[model samples]
Target chain A: MIEFDEVSYGYGGGPLLADVSLRLAAGSFHFLTGPSGAGKTTLLKLCYGELIASQGRVGLFGEDARSLGRDDIAMVRRRIGVVHQDCQFLDHLTVAENIGLPLTVSGRTATEEDLGELIHWVGLDGQRQSRPPELSGGERQRAALARAVVMSPDVILADEPTGNVDWDMSLRLLKLLVELNRMGKTVMIATHDLNLIRTAKQQVQARVLRIASHRVQLAGADL
Target chain B: MSRALAILQFLAGDAQADRVVPPTGFTARLTVFVSATMAFLTVFALALSLATGRLAENWSDALAQSATIRVSAPDGQVEDQVIAVMDVLATTPGVADARALTDDEQRALLEPWFGPDLPLDTLPVPRLIEVIETPEGFDAAGLRARLAGEAPGAVLDDHTRWREPLVRAADRLRTLGLVSILLIAATTGAMITLAANAALAANEQVIRVLRLVGARDAYIARAFVRRYTLRALAGALVGTLFGALAIWLMPEAEATGNFLTGLGFRGVEWLWPFTIPPLAALVAFMATRRAAFATLKERR
Candidate 1:
C-alpha cells in the first residue's frame, strides 16, 4: 500500500501539488482524473518513490519513501508496476523481450511457454518478434501493460493507459485492468478520460479522485 | 578478497545479463582502441623500469666488489712503484689479485677519447693496476693507508665517486619508469571514465527502462562494467602482443654494449607483459562502474 501524508511537491517553483493526503489500500481500484500538467503523473511518481514529496512524506509499503536508498527504492519498485502514457520501452527489444524485461531485470527466468501465454493474452502473439517502434499505439499500450504485470506485482500504477488508443481499444485495456483487480491486485490509473471511467464503472466499482486547484478531491457523481 | 571474487563472478556473467543493455558499437570500439594504445605504452614503461633496475643492480654489484690502484711515479720509477703496490695488495686479506696493466692495455682504456695510436710511453699517464677482490672485499681506507706508507706515489681508487653516480642515475631512471606507468594507468582510467559517461548519457532511455522494471544500480552498472572490462582485456592483449614482439625484435643485447638498447624482457621476465591486459581490464571495470553508479544516482 502507498500513502501520501499531507504531501506537497514542486520543481524549484511554486507548489504544483499541495496538501495531497491519499491512501491506496490493498485490493482497491482508483482512478485519478486531472487536466494536462495537473500533477497526476507527479503524484504517481511519488507513490513509487521516483519523486519524494517536498513537504510531507510519501510512504511505500509501510516505509517512508524519503528515507529509502537506491536499493530500497528498487525493492519497492519490484512490488509496484508502472505503465507510462508513452508506453516507454527499449525500442531495440522485441515485443516478447520487452514484456519479459521486468522478470529478466529481477534475475528471474521466464519460460518460453509463460512468455508465449502472456503475449497471446495481450493479443500480440503474431507481433512477438516485432520491435516497439513497429507496433501500433494500442499494441504499444498493451505491451506496456503486459510488461508491467510480468513480475506479478502487488500494485499497478498506470498513467493514461488509453490516451493514444481508440474507444474500443481503451475498453479492452480497461477490462484487462479490471481483470487484474478482480484477481486481488491494487490498481490506480491516472487519466482524464470520462468515457473510459464510465465504461470501467459498468464492470468494476472504482473510486474517482480529481486533481484541481493544486489539491486532490473525491469527485462528485458528475464525473 | 570478496570484492575480487565478486568482480570475477560479474565478468563470468550469464547470457540473460548480457542482453540487458544494448551494445553501442562506437563506445565499444573507443574503449578497445584507448585501452590497446595505453597498454602498449604501459608495456614499454614496464620494460624500461625493469631494465633500469637490472642495470643499477649490475653496476652496484660489479663496482662494489673491486678497487683499482694507480701509481704516478717518475717515468723511470713507475715500474718499481707498481711492483711495490702489487706486493702490498698481495699481503691484503680481501684482495683476490692485483696486476699492473701493460702499455697496450692502458692505451686500450683511453682508446675512445685519445684514439688507438696514442704514444702511451711518452705521456706521464700513471701506471694502472687492476684489482680483483674476494666476496667480502678489501677495506679501501685500510689499503689507502697502507699504500700511502709503502708506495707514497700510489693512489687507491675504490671507484666510489664515479660508481655511486652511475648507480644513482640508473636508480632514478627506474623510478621515472615506474612513475610513467602510474601516469599511464591514471590516464587510462580518466579516458575510460569519460567514455563510460558518454555511453551512459546516450543510453539514458535504456537505463530508464531497465530501472523502471526494478533493476538495481549495481545490476545496471554490471552490464556496462562487464562490457568495458572485456573490451579492455581484448584490446590490451593485442597491444601487449605487439609490444612484446617489438621488444623481441630489437637488436640483440650482446650486439651493442649500450645499456638502453637492451631494454626488453629476458628469460622469465617475458611473462610481465601478459599481466597488462588484466590490469587494463581492472582499470576499465572500476572506471565504468563509478560512472554508471554516479549517473544512475543523478537519474534517480
Candidate 2:
C-alpha cells in the first residue's frame, strides 16, 4: 500500500526522477526494469520511504513520507522489508543470525527449531552457523531474503535481489519472492534481468514498470 | 516469524555484528589512555577537596573553643597580673580550663626563632596564659573588661580574626578542587564524543548494512554505548586504583606545625575515590549515545 503521486527526486544538480505518479495496491507483485543508472533503485527507495522525493511527495502506508520523523520512518521500514542488490548484512554475524536480524532488532526471540526450519527452507541449513563473509553469493541473496521476510512485513522492496546469483540460484530467489507475494505480501523488485522477470510471470501475476526520462510507465515488454 | 527467530535477530544488532569493521586499535588505546589519565587527575582533585574539607573543619574546631590571655608588665608584676587574669577566667562560666604556661613551656614556644636558651628575666617578654572553653564558649567581653580593670596591660585573644581567614583559605581550596573535577568530567565527555564520532564515521558501511536489515537507530547506538561505556569504566577503574595508591604512598606527614600535613584521605574516607569509575562510565554513555543518535538521524 505505497503510493507516489507526481513524485520526483533529484540530486542537487538536477532531477533524476521527474513527475512520476504510481500506486502499488495491496498483495500485488511488480518488477522495475531499466538499464544501468536509470534511477530504478532510486524509485524503489522512494516507495519504501528510504529517500524522500526532493520535489514531490511519496506516501508510505498513507502518510506523506517527507513529513514523517526518523522514528516514524523506522516504523514504516519495519512494515516494509528491503533486500539490497549487495545483499547487505552484518558481516560479523552468522548466516542464521543475519537472516533473523529483523526479528532481533525488534526485540523478538526465535526458537532453534524455527530458525532451523527457516534456514532449511532457504537451502542454507548447512551454512546457518557461517558468517555472511563466509557465505557464497547465492547464500547471501537467500539470507537477505530471509531477513526481509522475517519481519512478516506487508511489503517487500528488493533492489536487484538476484543480481549476484547464478542462473539457478536466481530462479530460487525469485521463487522465494513470488511465494511471499502469493502469501499476500506486496513485492516490488528492481532488476535488469528480463528472463528472470519472465520466469516470475509463469508462477505469479506480476506487472513490469519501466523507468525512462525520469518517469514511471507500464512496460510494453511481457513474459 | 517465530518468537525465537525474532530474538536471535535482535541480538545480532550488537557491536560484535559490526566487528568486520575494525576499530582503530591505536585510537582505542588513545581513548582509554586519555580517559584513564583524566580519571586519575579527577581522583586527585576529589582527594584534595575532601582533604581540604577535613583540614578546614579541624582548623575551625581547634580555634573555635580556645583563646589566649597575654600579661605584659614589670617582672614582679607578672605574677600579680597572672593571678588577676586567673581570677577573671574563674568568673567566666563557659571557660573549661585555664593554665599558666610554665617558664620552660613558654620558652619552647619561642624556641623555633629564639633558640633554646633565652634570658627571659632580662627581656620584657609578655607572659602567656592558655585558656580553653566549652562548646558554648566563654563571654569574651566579660573577661576582657575584667582583665582591663585589673591587669591593665593584659589582652584577651579569642583567635577568631586569624582563624576566619585560615578557614576561608581552606574553603577556597575545597572550591577549587570541586571545580577541577567538573572540568575533568567535561574533558572526558569531549574526548569520548570525538572518539565515538570517529568510530561512527569509520563504520558508515556497517551502519548501512544494519539499516538495510531493519536495525533501528536505538539498536545501533546500544552497541556503541555498551562498548564505550565499558571502556571508560574499566579505564577509570584502573586509573582510580593507581591514583589512590599514589596518594596513599606519599611519605608520612612531618609536624611542621603546618595545616597541609593532612592533605590526603584518612581511614574509611578512602572509599570516596572509587565512585569516579561509575561516574566516568555514565558520562561516556551519555556522550556517545548523543553522538550516535545524532549521527543516525543525519544518516536518515
Cα TM-score per model: 0.96, 0.87
Model 2 CAPRI quality: acceptable
- Each candidate's DockQ: 0.80, 0.40
**Candidate 1 lDDT by residue in tens digits, A1-223:** 9998999999888999999999999999999999999999999999888898999979899999989998899988999999998988988788898898888888888779779888888899899999999999999999999999888889999999999999989989999999999999999999999989988888888999999999999999986
Point to the candidate with the largest TM-score.
1
lDDT of 1 at A133: 97
TM-score, model 1 to reference: 0.96
Candidate 2 per-residue C-alpha lDDT over B1-300 given as tens digits, one digit per residue, 9 for 90 to 100:
688786455434454344434556755776688779988998899889998998899889999989998889876898998998898888889999999999888899988899989887788989899999999998888888878998997999999889999999999999999999999999999999999899889888878866765667887888777778778888999999999999988766684346557767898888888889989988988999999999998887
Please state the i-RMS of candidate 1: 0.9
Chain A TM-score values, per prediction: 0.98, 0.96
Q: Which stretches of candidate 1 lie over 4 Å from their true place?
A: B1-8, B113-125
* Model 1 agreement with the true structure over B88-200: per-residue lDDT tens digits: 99999999888888998989999999998999878999989989999989888899999999899999888899999999999999999999999999998998998899899
Worst 10 residues of 2 chain B by lDDT: B11-20
